[model samples]
Every structure is written in structure tokens, then in C-alpha cells.
Target: MVAILGCCDSTNPVRRDGGLPGSVPAPSPGALRAEDQLPRQRRSLTSEDRSAIAVGVTCGCSYAQIGAMIGRDKSVVCREVTRNRGPDGSYWAPVAHRAAHERRRRPKPVKLAANPGLCRRIEVAMDEGWSPGLIAAMLRHEHPGTSAAARMGRVSHETIYQALYVQTRGNLRADLHRQLSLKRSARKSRGSTGRGGSHTYDHALTISQRPAQVADRAVPGHWEGDLILGRGNRSAIGTLVERSTRFVILLHLPGRRHDAPSVAQAMITEMSKLPAHLRRSITWDRGSELADYVDIQLNLQAPVYFCDPHSPWQRGSNENTNRLLRFWFEKGTDLSTHTPDDLARIAATLNARPRPTLDLKTPTQALHELLANPPAA
Candidate 1:
């Protein structure tokens, strides 16, 4: 029977109404399975994938044909066509494609974007010589009545540093780079020597020998001090910052060569103004400016501890304070031009600014509180 069936078609094929050809028997309606009637399986389309397909169609593929190719519903293709259509009634394929590509390529949005107006205000504050940390606290305090979403709340100084140093995505203004404190060259890696050199003052104490209470900041009077050298090595300013309060005191050095005697006399004179209990150990780097460390210790009745050579972190409070100081006295500028009154004004500004780390209190506030309640004898 099978041989007859095969031979019959080869010899005299029967013609169908549509064309002259041998026709295969169609499946009966009841015999056709549900699975057989279903469309072929296709890979699922993600939001991104759908966007791409939409762009591709807008560029010029027929809706039914694209649906067949991508295994999507024909209606999905039609909706995509309608959604991305321009105001001119034209479906711009290239524009849609570019938009999709850029959307997929974007990085996570910045926290600053939450309140752009606030960021601009913070930038203005920076231009006025306020530190990022200070600006962040001011935003929270001054704008308490504003909506939290609208306010530029607390952001760390480090966060501001990252935005300034790390290039922003889609940022068109390269000139904005100037707003950063450190130039790109300053960000490069540099090797540092350990605090190995010995100071000329024989009686000076090592930082390791400082009292446990001082190291832990349990008591309020311990301080870190250093010198900010200016151009020509002829001019310099002595800086002192209380560890607990971060209160800064700028010393007026008469001349570079007079630094030893001048720093010693300045420490004695300024520290004497504070109550006896407020004068504790002072930490300093091994710079020659402090060659008269013994005299400073003797006059103030406070031990002077020398940090390791080239170890700025040991006197981190002073180092951080110096960075803030740069806004007034920039690097490479002659410090001789600044008088004692000018330096004092800068120090006053720093002390008055609120510090986030100090619970949004100004250094002056912390210092006043310390003064009101002296430490136990």
C-alpha cells in the first residue's frame, strides 16, 4: 500500500485549487494538539532589550515581521513605534537608538543630584572659604524648615573631595576642576620617610611616651602644632590646633631664621593665656622650626612630643587645619605679606565654623564648654 501511494504521486499528481501540485492531507480540527497550534518559543525580552528592539523598528522594520523575528507580540512592536515617535509624526530611529544606548551606559546618579540647588549653594560657600564639612552642617541647620528632600543635608568633607577629584559623568565644564583644593599633580603617589631623624632638643619626648589620657583625647587640652612654610623659605606661620576642640592658633613668626626663638616665645605667650589645666602636652613634627622645643616645654609647663620625621599623620589635626589654612594663604604665595592681625582673623574664622565631627558645634563652643568645667585634678 505504501509503495502504491508513493508511485501514484510520481506518475499522475492531483492538483489542489490553489496551485497545480500534489497536496498532503491537512490535520483534522480535533486532531490538532494545543501545543502544535501555539507560536514558536522565543527568548524573553528585557526592558533594555525591548528598548533596543523598539529603536530598531523605528529605524525601519515592519511591526509583524519584527515581532516574528524577535518572537514578541505584534502589539508590543506597535506600542514601541508609538511611544518613541517624535512631535513631527516621524519615528526617528537613530535618535531612539542613541538614547537607548546612552541610558544603558549611564552610571548611578550622584547623591548631590538629589538637590542641585543645594550643591550650588555649597559650592558658593566653598568659594567664600568655607570648608565642605562646614557647608554640609550649615545646610542642615539653616534649612531645617525646608523639606528634607529640598535641603542639602549633611555630606562628609571626604564626599565633597571625591566629587572634586573624580570626574563627574557627562560633566561638560572642565573649568570646574579649579574648585578643588589640590591640583591633579598633588594627587600623585609619593614615597615618605619614616619619622626617623632626631630633634636637636635633647629633652623632647617621643609621641609614644605621651600620657594615655592625652592619646585617647579623654582630657581636652592636648594639641598638635606645625609650621606652614611660605615661598623663599623666608616666611612661615606657626599653627596650633587643640585635639579635642580643633581650635586653631596662628603664630606670627618674625622671620625664618628667628623661627626657633620666635616659635618658643609664641608658644609660651599664647599657651599662658589659657588656664593652667588647658595647657597639656603639645605634639610637633621634627621641623627645625621647633629647634627650641626644650624652651617651649619649660615655659608652658607642658611636655613637647616630637612626631617621627615626615610623619604628618602624627600631627593630623595640624595637617588638616593647614589644608583649610591654604584658602587664605595659598601655596607658593609669600606669607610675609600677612601680618599678625591677618593670621588671627583666619584662625578666628576656622574656630567659628561648625565641625560635623564635633556634633555640629563650633570649635569655640567646645572650647568654652571645656573652660566652664575644668578637668579633675
Candidate 2:
């Protein structure tokens, strides 16, 4: 392969009548040089290097071997070959060289710009409270064919996200951000820190005692519970999220009485309606509202576990649900103003939204599937 390296330099001033003895002929004038299109600082393949790649591909050399021959990395060879290969998988040096230069052109138009129909479809889904990822997945699902439209119709979740967040790529509707769950006008970085402590009560089980199946989400019915506090921590709504299905059930904790008995009674009343298999266990935060956990266990017939002090990630599902619930039940407001019926409606709405983790299935759909053919005892 080293013998093929003679033609790998584009700066060789010594010109041959035809070309290097055994090397592929220099790409025609139409095949632009790297310096012609890109800045000098950016490293791009030279015309000779592309010719070597063409020969290497024709000789059935691996990308790593080709890279060695051209003084580049295996990934560079792989990306060049994969990106510039012909429709029939052949690598013609001249064609590949031209394609590379074309790809280097800047300020290209966004995908949604030429596809109004795709923009409309994306907007409609967002308006229906669907995430960008779910909309992208559904697009791929609906356009599974290999035709140009089908191929062009499918955009990545990242593309949809960029269209929403990046002003340069803004082709979707201007107000579509309002349709997002968080409804932020711009992107934000997220991070978290965990706190450590043990359970305070001698009889209470900590998250460590919960069965391994609950952590793995191998079985349905394990639940994570929490409360979304309202203005001045006076009122709150109880939240329950099933681990496996991500199904949600909201408890109406009317008034400012979010104490132990009030919370436990509301939780028992809502969770008791489900089947025994669907009431396996409940993991909750260390708030005093769940002090009557024993009463909850007695009525629901499920063990109650407490998270370590200030460690909310142990109840991840419930925490996520509370965040979503905040969209409708905003902070600094009277949560008690919404009746039990309002809570039911909000829970149903949240459950109906599709989850990316659920393979785009709504929580309601996943729950119904479980009910249709539940696991045997």
C-alpha cells in the first residue's frame, strides 16, 4: 500500500505527462482542490488522496489500510467512502472529489424550508403536545418507503430540536416553542447533584430494600410517588408514576392540609382502585406528609419505601411527572382551586402523551397493553 503513496501529495510540482506511473490519473480540472473551497487551516482530502482512496476501494482494501496508505485516520477514510460512494457503491475519484467540494458549501438551506408539508406535520404534532423526538419517530414510521420523498421526509430528532432552538435554522413556526412541554423560548443546560442519608424511621424501608425488579423495571406496578407543592408550600397535588409503563395518577389534595393523614388517605383512595398486581410497591420522598405510610401500606397492601434525605432521583418517575404537571398546575398559584375532576383530566392528558422511552407509545396505551395480557402469578 505504501507504493500507492507517491500520488498522495497534491503539491508535487513535478508534473507527469499522463500521471504517476501506477497511480490513478489526477482528477480533472472540474474536481476542485481543498484550498479552492475551504480555508488553509481546515484539513481536507487532496485530489491525489481521493484518487488513492478510489484505487484502494477498487482493490478491496479496508478503511484502516487505506488510511495508512493516505496518511489519514481510518475514520476519515470510512466517512469519505461512505459519504461519497456512488449509488451502486462504487468509488469514482472524480465524482467523490466533486461531492466533497459541494458538501463544503456553507449557509445551506434548512430541510424544512423546502418541505412545507413536513413543517405543517411537525407543527401539528407539536400543537398536540408531542415532543420533537416523538414527531421525528412518527415521521420515519409513516414514511418507511425508500423513495426520495420517504427518505427526504424523515428528519432526525436533533434536526427538529435545532429548528426550534437555533434561530439560523428556524423554519418551523415561530410560536411552536409554546407547544413544547417546558415551553421555553430557548435551550437550557440541565444538571443535578445527589444528597446522601438513611431512613429516619426504624420500621420504614429505604429505597435500598426495594426489590431489584423495581430498579430494572422488569415488572409492572412498582410506583414512585411525590407531591408538587403550590404557592408558599401551602397546597399540593399528589403524584404517582408506575415504573414500567410510566403511567400517571394524580391525587387531589385540596386545601392547605397536605399533612400525613391527608396525603396517605388520598394516595390509598386512588391507588386502591388498581389490581393487586398493579399495586406492587410505592417509593416516596422523606416528606412528613407520608408519615402515615403504615396506613397506606395496610389499605393498598403494598410496601412503602422512603428515599434518602434530599435525594429526589430515587423517585425519578414521580419527579419527572411533577415537572410535566407544572405546565398545567403552575407554581405560585392555588393548586386547590382545581377540583378532583380537574386533577383527573390533567392526569389523563399527561398519560395520553407519548413517551420516547416507551417506543412512542402513550402511557395509557402501554398500561392498556399490560392489562390486556398481564403477567401471570
lDDT of each: 0.67, 0.80
- Per-residue CA lDDT of model 1 for 1-377, tens digit only, reads 00001112323332221112433443333433345555655553455445445434433445654454344666866776676576676665566556556656757666665656656776777777676678667766765744445444655565666666567622222444465565442244333432223537456688888888877777888989987878766778889999988999888876554457787888788888998788788998877777878788788888889875566788888889999998898878788788889988999999999999899999999899988877541
Candidate 1 has which clashing residue pairs, if any?
Answer: 195-308, 195-309
Model 2 Cα lDDT, one tens digit per residue, 1-377: 12232223444431232244554654332332344533323379988889878776665557866665555777998999988877788998899889888888898768887788888889888888898889888989988976677978889888888898888684798888888876778886532222122344557998998999999998999999988878877888889999989999988886778988899989988998888989999999877788888999999999999887667877888888888889899978988898989988988999999999999999999998888876641
Model 2 scores worst on lDDT over the 10 consecutive residues at 190-199
**Regions of candidate 1 where Cα sits further than 4 Å from its true position:** 1-180, 184-203, 256-258, 375-377
CA lDDT of 182 in candidate 2?
65
Question: Which has the greatest lDDT?
Answer: 2
Q: What is the TM-score of each candidate against the true structure?
A: 0.51, 0.55
Per-residue lDDT value at 316 in model 1? 82
